[model samples]
Structure formats: structure tokens, C-alpha cells
Target: MIEILDPAQLPRARAVGALVATILQTAKARCQVGTNLLDIDAWTRSMIEDAGAESCYVDYAPSFGRGPFGHYICTSVNDAVLHGLPHDYAVVDGDLVTLDLAVSLDGVVADSAVSFVVGQGRPEDTAMITATREALAAGIAAARPGARVGDLSHAIGTVLRAAGYPVNTEFGGHGVGSTMHQDPHVPNDGRPGRGFKLRPGLLLALEPWVMADTATLVTDADGWTLRSATGARTAHSEHTVAITRDGAEVLTLPPAA
Candidate 1:
């Protein structure tokens, strides 16, 4: 279902977006070396509860994943990319971790993700993270009224390809409203001037993720975590954007310190 928030609801959307962004930033800061994945999940839960917000992922039962995600946040490390279920693992130095989070505040939902290295950052891993972040920015910049969804995808794709990374479309961005995932699927790559046209008040979660070597993905035994087929490092970056009259407003920015 595609949901377009009324102008009055936009404030609630912004509130929810801020909450998600704040939690993600806090979780990213706490992802130090030797940090357990479960700990991050727990911390996220506490933050969500303290804010009187609801987690979009806790009882999420999507077909692509195992029913009931049962986690407060998605902790994707190293080769793992999407739908990373938190497990009993400690991050080590040089490990690339991706934190994806979604939450609802005042009945509006916002989703975002960030990928970074733990202790000592590696050149290649850092490059991959930068590429995904750049791609995400490109997508957001393309999200304006009258622009087609393909325009956003193409803008995002151009950057990833220029960075020499393969774009995976199996799982990309989606419309976000009262629920987590909604209609108007946004791929990482597509032709411009095609697909759904953007409209004011529309909310879209634009995510761009890339694997180092292959576009193929393998599901871990846990039936949720997605890893690169070649076991190469990966990175993902995302933001929830609201379509506006003049341009797109990125709602998932972290609160100013």
C-alpha cells in the first residue's frame, strides 16, 4: 500500500524520523570493538521504549525474512549486508558493521541505515561505505515532485557504478508510512523517466547497498542475514525522504548535538 501523509501528518513524520535517526546515531557510536551484537539490540530497545515509540521490526513478519524479526535493530557485519539478524558475535577491529533501524512515533514510521568500520578502518571498506553514502545522497537529490522513481534509482546507480561496485536490486528501498514497508519499490538501479511519479507528501526510504565483488547474495543458516556470495565486504546507506513541492526533504538526519 502506498501512503501519502497529509501536510498535518508531516510533523509526525518528522518526529518519527528524528527518533529513528537519533537511535541509529547512538547505536553507531556504541558499536565499538568487542561489542556484542545483542547488546546493540538491547540498547535500541531501551531507547525506543524510553521515547514511547514502537519498533517496526520487533514483530515484523515479512516473506523475505523469517517471521517475527525479534530484534530491535539489524546488525549487519563485514560480508553481511541486508536483513542481518542480531546474533551472539562480537565485533573485532576492522570489522565493517551496518546498522539498519525503523521505528514509529505518533503513528508515523521512518527507516534508515548506516555502515562503518569498527576500530581501525580499512581503505577498501571505507571506500565502499563512502560509495553507498554518496549513492544514497544522489537518490535523495532526485526525489522531487513530478520525478519518476526511476530517476532516483538511476541517480543512485550512476554513483555506485562510478565507484566500481555492483548494485543489488533484490532488496532495495520502499515506501514507508504508518507501517514499515509499503508500495513503490525503489531499486538501486533503473532507467530514468520510468516508473511511479513522485508526489508531494509521499515518503520513500531510499537505500543503496553494494557488495565488493558480486551482486549475488546467500542467506545464512539463520534464514535472515544476507551475505555476499563471494564473502567480500559490503556496505549500505539509507534515508527516509519526504517528497515536497520544490524538492525532497531528508527526514532521517540525526539531531544536532
Candidate 2:
């Protein structure tokens, strides 16, 4: 179900968004070459409790995934892109890591993800990460009120395809507010002027991801994990936005950082 928050609920939405953003940013800053995946999960747990928020992932069980995600954050490295379930592993220099986070505060939810190299990384990996960010921005730009879902998808797809990257849209963005994933699935590529029309008070999360070589995907042995189809590097970037009467407002930007 798609939710359109009234002014009263928008504040809670903003609070949830800020919490998600700050936690992810703080965790991203602490990740290093020697960081342990479990440690990262612990840190995320601490932050979520400190804020009196609930993790959208900890007990998450979707038909597509193994029951109970059991992790506070998604730690995707190199070949792992989406649905990355953290495991017992130590990050190595130049390892590409993507942190996907979602939290609910005061009955509202916000979700976002960021991809970055652990340390000094290969140029190709660096470029791929940047491309995902660029595509994310384009998608948000197309999320204004009166715009169609396909418009946003098309905007993101244009950027990724132009950069010579493959978009595996099996998993993309979706309606977000009282819950994590809602109706109106936002694909990474589509024809413009199609699909759900954007309306005021609607909240949507737009994410754009790309694999270096192929547009297919493979789930890992863990069942909750998703990796690049061709074992190629992948990157993802996302943001939670609210559709305003005039346009779109990104509710997840942390304080200037």
C-alpha cells in the first residue's frame, strides 16, 4: 500500500529519515580495512536502540528472503550488491562495501544505502560507485509530484546505460512510510510517462544499482544475499523522498556530511 502522510505525520517521517541517515553515515565513517562485519552490526544495533528506533531488518522475513534477516545493516562487499547479509569476515583494503539501512522511528520509516571503497580501491570500482550515486540523483530529480514512476525509472536508467553499466532491476525502489517496502515498485529502467503518478504526501524510496558486466543476479548460499550475476563488481545508492505539492523533498540527508 502507498501511504501519503499528512502534515502531522510528516514530522515523524522526517525524524525517521534523519535517524536512518545519521546511523548509516556514522557507520560508514567507522568502516575501515580491518573492520569486522559483526562489529559493524553491533554498532548499528547500538545506534538504533539509542534513538529508540526499530530496525527494519533485524526480524525482517520476506518471501524472497530467508526468514529473519538477523542483521541490523546490510554489508555488501565487492561482488555482493543487494540483500547482503553480514557474515563473519574482515574487510580488506580496497574492498568495495555497500551499507543499506532502514529504520522506523515514531511509526515512520526511512531507508537509504551508500557504496564506497574500504580503502584505496581500483579505479573501475571507484567509477562504478560514483555512477550509482549519479543515477540515484537522476532518479530523485524525476520524483516530483505529477511525475510518473516510469519517469523516475527512466531517468535513472538513462544515466546507468549511458555509463556502460547493466541495470538489474529485479530489485529496485518502492513506496515507503509506515513500512519499508510498499506498493508501486520503482524499476531502474522504463519508458517515461507511464506507471503510477506521483502525488503530494506520497513517500517513495528511489534506488539505482548497476553491475559491472551483466543484468542478471544470483542469490548467495545464505539465501538472503544477492550477488552480481557475472561475479563483477556492483554498486548501489538510494534515498527516501516525500512528494510535495510542488516537487520532491529528500528527507534523509544528514547534517551536511
Question: Which candidate has the highest TM-score of all?
Answer: 1
Residues 50-142 of candidate 1 have per-residue lDDT tens digits of 999999988998888777889999999999999899999999999999999999998899999999999999899989999999999999988
- RMSD to native, candidate 2: 0.8
- Positional deviation of residue 59's Cα in model 2 after best superposition, in angstroms: 1.3
Our tally of clashes for model 1 stands at: 0
TM-score of 2: 0.98
Instruction: Estimate, for each residue in 1-257, the C-alpha lDDT of model 2 and write its tens digit.
Output: 88888988988988888888899899999999899988999999999999999999989999999879999999999999998998999999989999999999998989999999988989999889888889888998888888999999999999999999977778999999888999899999999999999998899989999889999889998998898878998999999999998788898886683
Q: What shift in Å separates residue 8 of candidate 2 from its native position after superposition?
A: 1.2
How does each model score on lDDT? 0.94, 0.91
| CA error at residue 30 for candidate 1, angstroms | 1.4
Clashing residue pairs in all predictions, respectively, total: 0, 0
**TM-score of every candidate relative to the true structure:** 0.99, 0.98
